[model samples]
Structures are given as C-alpha cells and as structure tokens.
Target: MRKHAGEVGRYIVNGLVATAVHYSVLMANLELLDFQSAGVANFVAALFGIMVSYFGSRYFVFKNTVESIISQASKFGILYGLIAILHGFVLFVWADWYAFSYSTGFLIATVLQVSLSYLGNKFLVFKK
Candidate 1:
C-alpha cells in the first residue's frame, strides 16, 4: 500500500474516465437501443468500459513493467468478467426489481467496482 500511492491516484483518474465511457454506453443502450433489460444493457456497457479500463490500466494506471501483457490481461479479464456479472445483478435487483432509478443503481454498482478493481489490480493483476 505504501508503494502504490501514485498508482492509486492514476487508477482513480483512469476509473473516472472509464466510468464516463460506461455511463455513456449504458445510457445509449437504455435510450437508443431500447433495451428492456437493464442487466443486459449494463453487461454491454461494462464490456466497453472494461475495454477502456484494460488499456488505461495496463499503460497508465498499473504501468506494470514486470508482467507480460497477456498474463495481466488474462487476469484482468477474469476479474472484470466476474465483476461485470455481479454488477449486472445489482442493477437488475436495484432498478428492475425494486423499481429504483437506473442511475442510482448504476452509481452503487460503480462504487463497488471501484473498490474491487483497485484491490484486484493492485494485488492480483498488475503486480505493482
């Protein structure tokens, strides 16, 4: 933790950018694609968001110098895949079942992802 201060800051900045991409695509899917399922829409949006995060995390946030890109990416994929599934579940339950605002549910899920991602990337994927 002591050595990862800069990476944490970079992760926050990169995460914000990734979240922007996520929300944009989520809104577009909900509004433009006319998707009836928030879960599905979120899954799609997460795919895009995770892609952006992968590049940013690899090149910018983690700045991993010792690991192979393939190795990091494989772990990243697994981590984010699990996170995305859980994220969709949260959105489905919060917004779809409970009749809450999609925005609010998305916010909640994003917060969860932020914490999970930081820890996972730090200890598991990037190995910084």
Candidate 2:
C-alpha cells in the first residue's frame, strides 16, 4: 500500500512538471510567436511535453521498471500521440467553437489528458 502511494505521488509530480512545460510552451507559441492556429500551438507544446514526460516517467515515476529506454519511449510515444490528438481536438472545440480562451481550454484538456496519461503509464507502459 505504501509503495503504491509513493508511486502515485511521484506520478502526480511528474505530471505537474510535464503540464507546466506544456502550458509554458503553449502560451509562448501563441503569445510570443503569434501563432494563428490554436491547434498548431497545441501540437508544438504537446511535443515538448511528450519529451519531458518520457524522461520523467522513466526515471522518476516508474523507477523500478526493467524495460529499456527505447521500449518505454516507444510506448510513451504511442500513448502520447493519441492523447495529443485528443488534446488538439478538445482545444479546438473549446477555444474556437465555444469561444473560450486558449488558457481555459488548455486547463480543461490538461486535466483530461493527464488522467489518461497516468493510467496509460501505470498499466501499459510501465507495468510491473
């Protein structure tokens, strides 16, 4: 029980770090770079976050894993690829169709994607 609790805590921390990276890049791309399309900004941000998430999940969140880095990263790529697509769709709907701010859409999409990512990492990518 305690082990699982620790793992959960670490996983959440990793997620927070990755989410921060995601949001930062997203805002920078939109505001600083003046990206016209929310989807494009989101994709760029998600790509950066995916790289961070791969390393964080491998070394910090699932430290006991026996899988090789290549194997784990491949799985992470597959999982995050799908999540990224979902994120872009949600962001488009919320920001473009519903007239919400990009920041608001990002927050909502982050919550959804992070939940799915935790499950994917725990069960599929880093299974014990």
Candidate 3:
C-alpha cells in the first residue's frame, strides 16, 4: 500500500539519521577513545541517539508533540535502552563466535535494532 510505503520510507530516513548518531558515538568511543568495555560505550552512544530520535520523531517522523518532554524522552530511552542491550549482546556474541569484526556485526545489529525501534516508537510510545 502507498501509505505503508510512505511510513516505511519515513522509518528508514529517521532510522538512518539516528543510526548515524548512535554508531558514530559507539565507534568513536570504542575505537578512538579505546573504551575497555563495549557495554559502557554502548550506553554512552545510546544517550546520544536518544536525543536525535526524540527530536527527529517529534518534529519530522511522527510530527506529534509529546505531552511531557522528560516523560516522553525517558520512556523512549528506557524502552530503547532495553532493546539496545539485546542488540549489542547479540552482535557481541556473534562477533566472538564467528570471529568476525565487531564493527561488521555492530552494523548489522544496528539496522535490526533501528527497525524494531521504529515500530516501538510509532505504535507503543508516541501513539495518538
């Protein structure tokens, strides 16, 4: 359907922006700053992505004003944080098991997580 296609396109655009912010922070912290733990690096990256996602969805993607900025942001952060944990965990495990580069695994995981996040944000978190 055309409506679904539009939604998917918007989802992809929003996701690309958010993922860039998220993955950039993760890669920078882990590769440049040499963070010892990926979990910590992921946490830091997630915060950055959360801000991007909140504003992007608020104005561009969903075009809906949140009832409470703090509440909406916090709820979104907590929900996405949980999803990120699963995402990072899977990528880390697969990288270790298959002896693939963490960066590669991370990229794949990020795409998956972003799609899931779009669904969650659209249907659950910020619905009208």
Candidate 4:
C-alpha cells in the first residue's frame, strides 16, 4: 500500500506534465495552426500526449526498467489508442452533434482519460 501510494504520487506528477503537453498541442492546433476541425486537432494532439504518457509512465510512474521496451510500448500503444478513440468520440459528439464549446468537451474527455489512464497503466500496461 505504501509503495502504491508512492507510485500514485509519481503518476500524478507525470500525468500533469503529460496533460500540459496534450493541452498545448490541442490549443496550438486549434488556435495557432487553424485546424478546421477540433476533433481532428484533438486526435493529433492526443497522439503527442500518448507518446509523452508512455515515456513518462515507463520511466517515472511505474519505474519498470527491467521489462522489454518493445513489449511495454506495444501494450501502451494499444491501451492509449483505445483511449484516444474514446476521447475523440466524446469531443466529436459535443462539438458536432450538440454544437457546444470544444473546451467543455475537452474537459470531459480529459477527466475520463485521466481516470482510465491511471487504472489502465496500473493494472495492464505496467502491471508487475
């Protein structure tokens, strides 16, 4: 339990950094780059976030350096890919169907992603 608490702390730190990267890419694509579609932009940003997430979780959160990088990366990719799809879907529904602010959709999707990511990383991707 104590060790897991430490891991949770590390995970939150890594998650904050990764979320910064994600939102930066998202805002850049939406505001600076002038991406026509928020959903597409979000998808691209999420890909970047996924990369940051994998590296951060591997080295900082879980601290599992003994495992094969290839094996871990493959599993990480799969898990995050599913997450990205769901993230995009939620945003798509909000922006496209309801014509709501993409920002709100982004928040909702982010909350879901954060929850799923911690659980998935702990139980599946970085499981011992």
Candidate 5:
C-alpha cells in the first residue's frame, strides 16, 4: 500500500513537470510564433512533453523497472502516441465543434491524457 502511494505521488509530481513543459511549448507556439493551428501547436507541445515524460517516468515514477532503455522508450512512445491521437480528437471536438478556445480545449484534453497516461505507464510500459 505504501509503495503504491509513493509511486503515485512521484507520478503526479513528474506528470506536473511534463505538463508544464507541454503547456509552455504550446503557448509559445500560439503567442510567439502566432500559430493559429491548434493541432500543429498541440503536436509540437506533445512531442516535447513526451520526451520529458519518458525520462521522468522511467527514473522517477517507476524506478523498479528491469526493461532496457530502448524497450522502455519504445513502449512509452507507443503509449503517448495513442494518447496524442486522443488528445487531438478531444481538442478538435472541444475547440472546433463546440466553439471553445484552444486553451480550454487543451485543458480538457490534458485531463483525459493524464488519466490515461498514468495507467499506461504503471501497467503497460513499466510493468514488473
């Protein structure tokens, strides 16, 4: 019980760091580059976030793994790739179909993605 709690705590902290990177890149693309395409901005941000998340999840969140770095990264990439697709779908529906702002869509998508990511990382990617 205690071990699971510690893992969950670490996952939350590392997830926050990765999410910050994701949002920063997204906002930079939107505000600095004047990018109007939410899909493009989200993709770029997710790429950066995935990189950060891979390291953080591997070393900080699930440190008991025995998989090689390549194996772990491949699994992580697959998981995030699926999650990114889901994020894109949610963003499209919320921002385009429902007439929400990009930021709002991003926030909603982040919640969905984070929930899915925690499960994938714990059971699929880093399973003992």
Candidate 6:
C-alpha cells in the first residue's frame, strides 16, 4: 500500500516534469520555428518529454537498482515511447479530424496513457 502510494506520487510529479518539457518544446517550435502544425508540434514535444521522463522516472520515480542507467532508461523509454506514440496519434486524430480542442484530446489521452504507464513501470521496468 505504501509503495503503491509512493509510486502514484512519483508518477504525478514526473508527469509534471514531462508536461513542462512538452510545453516548452511546443512553444519553442511555434514561436521560434513557426511550426504551427499541431501534429508536428506534438511529435517534437513527445521527444522532449521522453528525455525528461527517462531520467526522472528511473532515478526519482522507480529508483531501480539496475545495472546501468542507460540500460534501465532504454527499457523505460521503450515502454513509454509506445504510450507516447499512442498519445500523439489520439491527440492528432481527435483534435484535427473531430474538431475537439487540443486540451480535451490531450486530457483523454493522458488519462489512458498514465494508467498504462503506471502498471508497466511498476511491474516491468522496476520489478524485482
């Protein structure tokens, strides 16, 4: 129970960091590069997010005593990269095609992705 609570808390904090990274990347692309396409922005933001989440999750969230940070991070990256791709797809499809607000689409996708990420990270990435 305690461990689960800690994991949840860590996930939330790490998510905030990832969100910051995402937003920063998006803003940079739009403001500096004039890339106004939401899909392209989403992809770039996801890459930044993955970088932040990899280190944050490995050291701060999961704290796995693994062989090397690179190995553990790569495994973690693979897991969340799958989730991020799904998130990007959903964001693009619903936001662009259905005319849903980007915020709304992102909210729905984050809820789904976060649930999957929690289980996968707890059981697979940092498992004993």
Score each candidate by Cα lDDT: 0.92, 0.90, 0.77, 0.91, 0.89, 0.80
Question: What does candidate 1's lDDT look like per residue over 1-128, in tens digits?
Answer: 86578878889999999999999999999999999988899999999999999999999987875788788889999999999999999999998899899999999999999999989988899875
Query: Sorted on TM-score, highest at the top, how do the candidates line up?
Result: 2, 4, 1, 5, 6, 3
Per-model TM-score versus the true fold: 0.94, 0.95, 0.82, 0.95, 0.93, 0.85
Model 1 lDDT, full chain set: 0.92
Question: What is the alpha-carbon lDDT for the whole of candidate 2?
Answer: 0.90
Between the candidate structures 1 and 4, which one is better when assessed by TM-score?
Answer: 4
Worst 10 residues of 3 by lDDT: 90-99
**Number of the top candidate by lDDT?**
1
Cα lDDT tens digits for candidate 6, 87-115: 88888897777877776777788788778
What is the clash count for each candidate, in the order shown?
A: 0, 0, 0, 0, 0, 0
In candidate 5, stretches whose alpha carbon ends up further than 4 angstroms from where it belongs are none
Ten-residue segment with the worst summed lDDT in candidate 2? 61-70
Poorly placed runs, candidate 3 (over 4 Å): 1-4, 96-99
TM-score of 3: 0.82
Better by lDDT, candidate 3 or 1: 1
Output the lDDT of residue 43, model 2.
91
Clashing pairs in 2: none
- Sort by lDDT, best first: 1, 4, 2, 5, 6, 3
Candidate 2 versus the native: TM-score? 0.95
lDDT of 2 at 118: 91
- Candidate 2, residue 113: Cα displacement in angstroms equals 0.7
